[model samples]
Target: FHDFLSVLLCGHKIQAKLSSNDKKLLPFLASYLCAVAPEFKPFITFTEDTLKNFDAVIATGSNNTATYFDHYFSKYPHIIRKNRNAVAIITGKETPKQMQSLADDVYRYFGLGCRNVSKIYIPQQYNLDHFFNGMYAWKQVINNHKYINNYDYNKAVYLMSDIKLFDNEFMLLKEDTGYSSPISVVFYERYKDINDVKAQLEDQKQNIQCIVSLEDVPFGVAQTPALSDYADGVDTIDFLIKL
Candidate 1:
């Protein structure tokens, strides 16, 4: 990490967005990096105005936020923007053990991270009982969280409001024709044929990060991502250097 910072500070200034809620962590993180390599001390800024003066820009945010960022940084010479997304994949021969392992990918961090599994495209004849049985353990932990409770309440209110919206409180609602982040809603079309599933996955290739399943599809991993993974088709160092 210190070596990377040394490379970044060679001729570049670092402008970062620090959430108001996370102000405390920022100083500690910055100080730690500087301790390892004192050269990084002069390159840090924590304001948006400072961000605009940079040679390039990088922004991490939800899909909604990424849209706004594109509009805001349109005139910049270079930019990298990340949007919200999650992983899902089709599998036909998953065993009980595999199903349990996949459940960790689904429920970890309460389905918040982009690497988390938000959807599963299983076959039409797939045994949902074993899948749900593996996931049953997470129900209590999910119920205990206050935000999930609020999400459940908000979904219920929307359902009863007579508004024209899809509402499936028992499972997450999926009608946006895109990904949903930080929630447990999955949207998938069941397929009888593997070729059809392959075609659908190919069509959504640009939108996906990781595809986890029992089948050994090309470039598919079982779960999670490595540190070297380039998110949203953008290189991390290339983003920073342009700025």
Candidate 2:
């Protein structure tokens, strides 16, 4: 809801369709919207036929939904579809203070946003104590959630079954073969040379969004994103303008 409001404030007329489960929150949210921006009366229901009336469509969803959007909306002149994603930073010389600040990027919004850092690429010799200590603040939040409980339970079951996966409160399960988004998880690879690391990152470039690294390069920043940042392999305005 806040995300939509942010975009709408930027001069966009958003036509939102809430999932059936989210319908209960619509009336309250609508009332709030009316108070803030009376011109924006968001609709609650939608049908397939109604979608054709739009000049352009911007669909934000999972890889499955991206596939569906591609099949159904590709015939249209303008369509922008995005897959789920997140961001992470790599720091070889991270101090305790830096790690603490980095925790904000990882745990904010329950690590749900596409820009959240789901994985960190750190040197093999990095101190785990500093990283975990920084993230300790999230323990209570993770314990109070039902979804995190399910993930932890499933993680334990997988461990008992000798299934290899990552495990933690905020994130777990790495080495996944396909698209990984949300639910923070880190995958590590050892490199003997800088060229090897560069080659590996280049190979996975298509699947990557922001790369947080200490290396001085054109897109390698500490923990911030520019306004022009693109996500999930698509441009935001390009997608919106097409629609």
Candidate 3:
């Protein structure tokens, strides 16, 4: 949000869609922008009312919330974003540095961003040592108070149950088929054929934000996205330019 807002502060943006909670710092950020430029706030509105007072919209939310946005904003020229996660297709041959770099995609933003690598696709009977070694640099993240709380909670739940998990004293790895993993927990799956997995991912392109591999995108570069890297592959500038 800050990225787009900062760009618009050059005195050209018109409107934005924000929730009620998004305006908490409106006074501060807006005041700061006003100090930076005199005519900046005229084109901005921080309202939560559902009124058709804008030319277009960009709505982002979870998959569940996207249903409501699609229905309510169906008449508007809008881009509704749903829950999407990034994945890493590991071939079990990455160097130690590459593995450690991959850890950035997982631990960055505390595994909360859509670009975070929540699920990793590995080959059948893949070695786990390399995966563990790559994430060693971020092992210190476990010391965070909030992170350790979640870690302890998930570890206890998996322990009392019979779920087989791999624990390296910080993050927990579970062999699951799901893409969205909880904090301190990452889900992984085994794939025998890379082409088959690619086909499956292609079929569900709308459900994914990005795919990270050595050949595709370098590790640790997910969060530091380029301006052209539009979310959901919908060109925001193109839409506005057409408008």
Candidate 4:
């Protein structure tokens, strides 16, 4: 939103209509925006009614809300975001420090961020010890009551379903093909070849946010995206300029 505002301000005067499911967040966010750009204060609003009259919209919402945005804003120029997950490529050759960094990337924000590493692709016959040891750095997350509840619940459900999992006393790792994993859990899948994993990920690019690897995003920095690192790989500034 800030980037869009910056680009839009380069030309015409702007009126920003803001609406959030968390009503309390709007006031704080609006105030912060005003602090950053005082000129935005008068032009900003908290009403959804004004949104319909906007010439263009850039919306980020939940899967259900995105569907609504797609239909309701179809008449206008818009950018609507859907759900996306991040995955890590585990080659089993990472140094102890890199392994720790990968763990930090996954457990940061308690694995709630869209860019958090929720799944991993590892080579066949890879040792799990390296991953588990690295994850020990975030064992404190298991002490958070909300996080622990989800952890225990997910552990019981997986056990009851007879699903195989790697238990680390804090985080659970299971072999699965899905991208999004539950809180306190991460999904992993073994690959016979790196090329195959890359090919598969390419086919699912639309559903993926970032590919964390020694080569791609580097470990422990998924949440700290550079200005050029646009979400869903779409260049927002460029898109806004094109508009």
Q: Please provide, for model 3 over 1-243, each residue's C-alpha lDDT reduced to its tens digit, 9 standing for 90 to 100.
A: 643563373434545555554666655677787788868767666545655566566778988999998998888887888999998899877889989999999999899899999989999989988999999999999889999999999999999998999999999999887789999999998999989879888998887889888767788897777877888888776666565
lDDT of each: 0.59, 0.55, 0.82, 0.83
Summarize candidate 1's per-residue lDDT along 1-243 as a digit string, tens digits: 322353364567667666555467666877887899887788766564545556555666666877887888878754444643555555656666666676677767666666676766657776567667656555665466665675686566656875343333334534344565335555555568878766876787666666676543221242445545666656666655544
Clashing pairs in 2: 56-243, 90-212, 166-173
The clash number for model 1 is: 2
Residues 136-221, candidate 4: write the lDDT tens digits: 88888888999999999999999999999999999999999898899999999999999999999999998899999988999988
In the range 170-227, model 2's lDDT, one tens digit per residue, is: 6563543333533544444433455655665568775555554445322223236655
lDDT, residue 156, candidate 3: 95
Error of 3 at 113 (Å): 0.4
Ranking of models by lDDT: 4, 3, 1, 2
Cα deviation in Å at residue 41, candidate 1?
2.1
Which ten contiguous residues of candidate 2 have the minimum total lDDT? 214-223
Number of backbone clashes in candidate 2: 3
Q: Cα-based RMSD of the predictions, in order?
A: 4.7, 4.7, 2.7, 2.5
Give candidate 4 regions above 4 Å deviation: 1-30, 48-50
Off by over 4 Å in 2: 1-13, 20-33, 40-52, 87-89, 163-185, 215-227, 238-243
Clashes of each: 2, 3, 0, 0
